[model samples]
Target: MALWSGRFEQGVSEGAQRFGASLPVDRAMYAQDIAGSIAHARMLGRQGILDAADVERIEKGLLNIKRQMDEGTFVWDLNDEDIHMAVESQLIRDVGAAGARLHTGRSRNDQVATDTRLYAKELLLSLVDGNDALRKVILTSARTNFGVIMPGYTHLQHAQPVLFSHHLLAYFWMLTRDHVRLVAAWRSADANPLGSAALAGTTYPLDRAYTTELLGFSHPIPNSMDAVSDRDYLLDLLYACSVSMMHLSRLCEEIITWSTTEFGFITLSDAYSTGSSIMPQKKNPDFAELTRGKTGRVYGDLMGLLTTLKSLPLAYDKDLQECKEGAIDAAGTLQDAMACVGGMVATWQVNADAMRAQASRGFTAATDVADYLARRGLPFRDAHEVVGELVLYCERRRKGLEDLTLKELRSFSPLFDDDVLEGLDPEGIARARTTYGGTGHEAVKTQLREAARQLGRDRRQASSLRGRMPNVTGD
Candidate 1:
C-alpha cells in the first residue's frame, strides 16, 4: 500500500505508481534523507513534540535502515514512490508507533526539499575538490613547460607569439571563476528547509535552529512558503556545472586541434589516446573529443530544468519532481569530464620544437614589427600600414619576417636596423611582453605563483565545508 493511500478508496494503478515514482532518481540521496530524518527526530524530542524514548527509537531505526542501504540489503518498493517514503516506511516497521510520530509536524514537501539541499551541499563540496584537482593539473603543466612558445590566435589566425604557460593559465583563471560559482551554489544550498512543513509554518513548536545545527545547515530558511518550493539552489548548481563543462569543452577543443597532424603541437599519451583498427598509423584523441561532445548534454540538462520550473505555480507540485535527475546527471557529467581532462593534461607530451616552428611560420612577428616601428617615431597607424605591406611582401616571396635582410627591411622603413632581427625572433617576441598579465616568461611565473595560492585557498575552504557537515557513515 502507498503511504498516503489510507484516505483513498482505491489503490493507484501499477502504471501510475511506476510513472509517479522518484525512487530511481532519488535513491542516490537516501543517505541524505536518513540524515535529515534523524535531525528532525532529535529536534522534535528537544521541542517536546515527541518524547525522548520515541526519538531514540526513531534514531536507531534510521541508522539501521542506513546500514541496510550501505550493505545493499535495503529492498526498494516502487509503491514507496520516493526516497522519503521508502525510508519512513522502513522506520515505521522497525520502531512501530515511534516511527509514526516522526512526521507529526512535517510534510513530504519540506522533507524532500531538505534532502535535496543536503545532497546538493555534499555534491558541491565534491565538485570543489574536483575543480581544485583540475586546476593543480593545469598549474603543473604550466610550470613544466614554462618557456615553450606557441602561436596565439584570434579567429584561428596567428596574431602573436605567447608562452604556452600563459595560454594554459588563461584556463586556470576561467576555472577560478568557476570555483566562485560553485561556492555560491554551495551557499545557496546551505539553508535548512526542515521546519517549513508543507509550504507553511508548522503547528508544532519546532526548533528549526536545532535541526539546522544538527544537519550542518548555516541557518533555517526565513520564509516558510519559499522553503518547500524554492529550487534556485539547484539551478545555481546546474548553471555552475554548465559553465564548467563549457570551459572544459573549450580546452578539449584546443587539445584536439593541438594533437592533430597539421598542428603537431602536442601528442596525447598512449593511455589517453586510441588507435584505429584499419589505419595502423592513426592515433586518435577520442577522450578529448568526447568531453567536447558531452558539453551539449550538460547544456540540455540546464535547459530541461529551466523549462520545467518556468510556469509552475508557487509551493510544491508534481512538476517539481522533475528537477532532481537533471541536476544529478549534470553533476555526474562534470565530475567525469573534469577527471578525464585532468588526466589528459597531466600525461600529454608537449612538442616544443613543433610549437616553436609553427609559432614562427604564420607571420606571428607582424605585431612586433608594428610595435618596433611604433616605438621608433612613426604614428601607430603608419607603423601598422608598414607591417601590413611587409607581411604582404613576405607572403608573395614565400618568406617570413625573419628571412628578410636588414636592407630588405629598410626598403619599407628607414627605422629598420639589425636590432629589428632580434624583434622578429619568436622567443624574443614572446618574452618582450613584460607588462603584468602579458605572455612574458616573468609574468607567467608570477601568474603561476598566484594560481598556486588561489588553489590552496580553495582547497582549504572545501576542507572547512567538509568538516562542518554532519559525519554520516558511508556518505
Candidate 2:
C-alpha cells in the first residue's frame, strides 16, 4: 500500500501509480535518501520529538535497509512511487511504530529537497575531480610539447605562429572557468532544506541548524516555500555541465581537424580511433567526433530543465518530479565526456614535424616581417602595407616569404635586409613574441607554472570539501 493511502477512499489506478512513479529515476539516490533519514531521525531524538528507543529502532532499521540496498538484496515495489516511500515502507515494516514516528515533523516535500541537495553535492564533487584530472592531462601535454610551433588561427585561417603549449593552455583556462562554475553550483546546493516541511515552516520545535550540521550543509535554507520549490541549484549544475561540455566540444573539434589528412598535426591513438567498416584505409577519430556530438545533448538537458521550471508556481508541485532525470543525465554525461577527452589527450601522438611544416606555410611570418620593418624606422601602417604587397608578390609567384631573396624583399622596402630572414624562421617567429601571455617559450613556461599552481589549488579545494562531507555509512 502507498504511504499516503490512509486518507484515500481507494488505491490509485494502476496507470496513475506507474505515471507518478519516480522509483526508477530516484533509485540512484537511494544512499542519499537513507542518509538524510538517518540524520533526521537522530535530530528528532535529540529534540525529544521522538523517544530514544524509537530513534534507536528507526536508525537500526534504516541502516539495515541501506545495507540491503548496498548488497543488492532490497526489494522494490512499483506501488511505492519513489525511493523515499519505498525505503520508508520497509522501515515501518521492520521497526513498527518507531519507523512511523520518523515522519512526524517532516513531509515528502522537504525530504525530497534534502535528498536532491545531498545528491547534487556528491555529483558536483565527482565533477570537480573529473575536471581536475582533465586539467592535469592538459598541463602534462603542454609541458611535454612546449616550444613546438603551430599555426594559430583566427576565423579558421592561419593568423600567427604559436607554441602548441600556448594553444593547449587556452583550453586549460577555459576549464579553469568551468571549475569555478562547478564550485558555484556546489555552493548553491550546500544549503539545508530539511526543516521546511511541506511548503511552510514546520509546527514542531525542529532544530534546523542541528540537521544542517548533521547533513554537512553550510546553513539552513532561509525560506520555507522557496526551499521546497527552488531548483535553481540544479539549473546551476546543469549550466555548468552544459558549458563544460561545450568547451570539450570545441577541443574535440580541433582534435578532429588536426587529425585529418590535410592538417596532419596529430594522430589519435588506435584505442581512441576506429577503422571504417568497409574502407581499408580509413582510421577515424570516432571518440572525438562523438564527444563533439554529445555537446548538443547536454545543451538539451539544460534547456529541458529550464523549460520545466519556467512557469511553475512557488511551493512543491507534482511538476517538480520532472527535474531529476535531466540533472542525472547531464552529470553522468559530463563525467564520461571529461574522462574520454582526458584519455584522448593523454594518449595522442603529436606530429611536430607536420605542425612546423604547416606553421611555415600560409605566410604565418607576415606579422613578424611587418614588425621587423616597423622596428627599422618604417611607420607601422606603411610597414603593414609593404608586407601586404610582399605577400601579394609571393602569392603571385606561388612562393613563400622564406623563398624570397633579400633583394626581392628589399624591392618592397629598403628596411629589408639579411636579418629579415631571421623573422621568416617559424621557430624564431614563435619565440620572438615575448609579451606577457604571448606564445614565446618564456611566456609559455610562465603559463605552465601558473596552470600548475591553479590546478593544485583546485585539487586542494576539492579535498577540503570531501573532508567536510558527513560519513553516510558507518564503516
Candidate 3:
C-alpha cells in the first residue's frame, strides 16, 4: 500500500497502480534521488527535527542502496509507485521508525524536482562534451584540407568559388550557437527546490540554503509553487537537443549528397558504410541517412514535452510524469548521433580532385570577370550587363570565360586587357575574395584560428561546470 493509504477506505486497483507508476522511467535517476534524500536527511538532523542517530542510520542505509545500485544488484519493486516509495518503504523496514522520519518535512513534489535538476545538469554537460568532440573533428578536417577549393552555393546553384575549409566552418558556427543554448539550460536547472514541501512552504524551519550548499545548487528557488511545478529547464534541454540534432541532420544530408555518384565529393569509409544485400556493387552511407531520418524523432520529443507542460495548473500534476521520457530520449539520441557523425567525417576521404573539377564548370568565374570590367572604368550596372552578354556568347560557342582570348574579350569591352586573365582561374578566383568571413584561403585560416580558440574556451567552461555538479560527499 502507498504511504498515504492510512486515511483511504481502500487501496488503489492493481491496474491503476501500474498505470500511474513513474518508477520504471525515473529509476534511471537513482543516483540523483539517493543523493537528494541523503542531503535532506542530513538537513533534518542539523535543524534538530530528527535525532542524529536516526540521520546516521538513514545515511548508511541509503549509501548501501546506492552501492547495490552501482553493483547492479538493487532489486526493483514493481508494486512501488515510484523510486521514492520504494526507497522509503525499504528504509523503514531496515531501519525502523528512524527511516520513516526521512519524509517528515518534505513531499514527493520537491524531491522529484531536485532529482530532475541534478540529472539535467549531467545530461547538459554530456551534450557539451558531445558538441565539443564533434567540433574538434570538424576543425581538424578544416585545417587538414585547407587548400581544397569548392563551389559555394546559393539556391542549390554554384554562385561563387570558395575554399573547402570555409564550407565546413559553417557547421562549426552552427554548433557554437548550440553551446549558447546549453548554457541557458544549465542555468535554469542549477537551482535547489528540495525544501518546497508540496505546494506550500513547510513549517519545519528547514534551512533550504544548507541543503542547497550540500547539493551544489546555485540557489534555493524562491517560490514553493513554482519550485514543484516548474519544468522549463527540461524544456530548455530538449530544445538544445532538438537544435543540435537539426544541425547534425543538415551535415548528414550533405554527406549523403556528396557521396553520391553524381557529386563524388567524398568517399565514406567502409566502416561507416554498408553494402546492399541485393546490389552487388553498392557502398551506401546508411548511417548518415539514418542520422538525417532520426532528426524528426528528436523534434517530436521536444514538441511532445512542450504540449505536456502547456498551461498545466500551478504545482505538480500527473501530467508532469509525462515529461521525463522524452527529454531522456532526446539526449541519448543526440549523443549517439554526434558519435556516429564524428566518426563518419573523421574517417571519410575527401575527393579534392573531383571537387576542384566541378568548381570550374558552373561559370563560377562570371562574377570575377564582371568585377574585372567594373575595375577597368565600366559602370557597375553596365559591367553586369556586359558579363550577362558574355555568358550568353560563351554558352552559344561552348567556351568558358577562361577560354576567351584577350582579342575576343576586348571586342566586347576594351577594358578587358591581358591582365584580366590573372584572376580568372579556379584557385585565383577562390583566393581573390580576401574579405573577412569570405572564401579566400587567408580568410578561412583566420576562421580556423578563431574556431579553435572558441572550442577550447567552451570545453573549459564545460569542464568547470562538470566539476561543480552535485556530489554525495558532505562537502
Candidate 4:
C-alpha cells in the first residue's frame, strides 16, 4: 500500500506512479536515513514521547531492516517512492505500534534533508583528500624537475626561459584555491535540519539544538521554512566539483600536449595510454583526454540543478527532487578523475634532456639580454629595440643569440660586453629570476616546502573529520 494513499480515492496511474518515484536514485541514502531514524527514536524516548520499551522496539526494528538490506534479503519496491517510506514500512511491520510512533514528530522532507547534509559533510572531506593527493603528485613532479628549463610562452610564441618546476607549481596553487572552495561547501552542509518537519517547525516540543549537538552540527538551521526547502549546500558542493573538474581539465590538457611527439616533454606510462588499432607506433594519452572531456558533463550537472531550482517557489517543492542526482554525479566524476590523474602522474616519465633542449631555442633568452643592456644605462624601451634588432639578425643568419661573438654582439649595441654571453644561456636566464615567486631554483624549493606543509595539513584535517563524522547522530 502507498504511504500517502489515505487521501486518494483511487490508485495513481502507472505513468504517474513511475514518474513520481525517487526510489531508484535515492536508495543510496538508505544507511543515512536509518541512522537518522535511530537518533530520532532515542530523542523521542528521552522527551517522554515514547517509553523505554518502545524506543528499544523501534531501534531493534530499524536495525533489523538495515540488516535485511545488507544481507540482500530485503525487496525494494518501486512503488514505495523513496527510501524513507520503504524503510518506515518495514519498521511498522517489525515493531507494530512503536514503529508507527517513529514518525510522531518527523516528515520525509526534513528527514531527507538531514540525511543529505550528513552525506555531504562526509563527501566534502573525501573530495578534499582527493585534491590533496593530486596536489602531491604535482609537487613530486615539480621537485623532480627543479633545474630543468623550458620555453615559457606568451600567445603561444616563445617569450622567455623558465624552470619547469615553476610551471608545474602554478597548477598546485590553483588546486589549493579549489580546496578552499570545498571547505566553504563543507561548512554550508554542517547545519542540522531534522526538526523542521515538512515545511514549518514541528509541534512536538522537540529540541532542535539538542539534535544539532548530538549530530555534531555547527548549529540548528535558524529558520524552519528554509530548513526543509534549502538546497544551497548541494549547489555549493556541485559548484566546487564543477570548478575542480575544470582545473583538472586544464592540467589534463597540458599533459596531452606535453606527451605528444611535437612537445615530447613527458611520456605517459603504457597503463595510462592506448595504441591506435592500425598504427603500431601510436601511444595515445586517452586517459588525459577523457578527463578533459568529462569537464563538460560536470558543468552540465551544475547548470541542470541551477535551472531546476530557479523556477521553484520559496518553500519546499517537488522540483527539489531534481537536485540529488546532479550532486551524486558531480562528486563521483571528480573523485574518479582525480584518482586517475594522480595515478598517471605518479608513474609518468619526465624527459629532462628534451625539456632542456627546447628551452634555449627561438632566442628565448632575449628578455635577459634586453635586461643586460638596460642595466648598462640604456632605457628599457631602447634596450628592447636593440634586442629586437639582434633577434632579427639572428633569424636572418639562421643562428642563435648565443652563437654571436662578443665583437659581433657589441656591433649591435656598444653596451654589450663579454658578460652578455652569460645572459643568453637558458640556465642563467632561469636562475636570474630571483624574485620571491619567480622561476629560480631557490623559489621552487620554498614552494615545495610550503606545498608539503599544506598537504600534511589537509590529510590531518580529513582524518579528524572522518573520526568525528561517523559518530554524528542524525538528530
Give residue 126's lDDT in candidate 3 (0 to 100). 91
Local accuracy by lDDT, each model: 0.92, 0.92, 0.91, 0.87
**lDDT digits (tens) for residues 234-309 of candidate 3:** 9999999999999999999999989999999999999999998899999999999999989999999999999999
Residue 163 local lDDT, model 2:
96
Q: Residue 260 of model 1: what lDDT?
A: 93
Q: How far out, in Å, is residue 207 in model 3?
A: 0.7
TM-score per candidate, in order? 0.98, 0.98, 0.97, 0.96
Could you tell me the lDDT of residue 108 within candidate 2? 94
Per-candidate clash tally: 0, 0, 0, 0
The candidate, 2 or 3, that scores higher on lDDT is 2
**Model 4: lowest-lDDT 10 consecutive positions:** 466-475
- Name model 3 segments beyond 4 Å from true: 473-475
Off by over 4 Å in 1: 472-475
Worst 10 residues of 2 by lDDT: 466-475
Off by over 4 Å in 4: 470-475
lDDT of 3: 0.91
lDDT per residue as tens, model 4, 1-475: 7877899899989999899888888887777788888878888888998899999998888888887777789888777889999999888887898989999899888999998888888778889989988998899988887788888887877888888889989989999988888888998999999889998877898877777766668888988889998999999999999999999998899899899899999999998999999999999999999999999999999999999989788788989888888898899899999999998888889898887889889889888888998989999999999999999999999999988998888888899987888656788888888888888788778878988898788778777766656353222
Which candidate do you rate higher for TM-score, 1 or 4? Answer: 1
> Candidate 2 has which clashing residue pairs, if any?
none
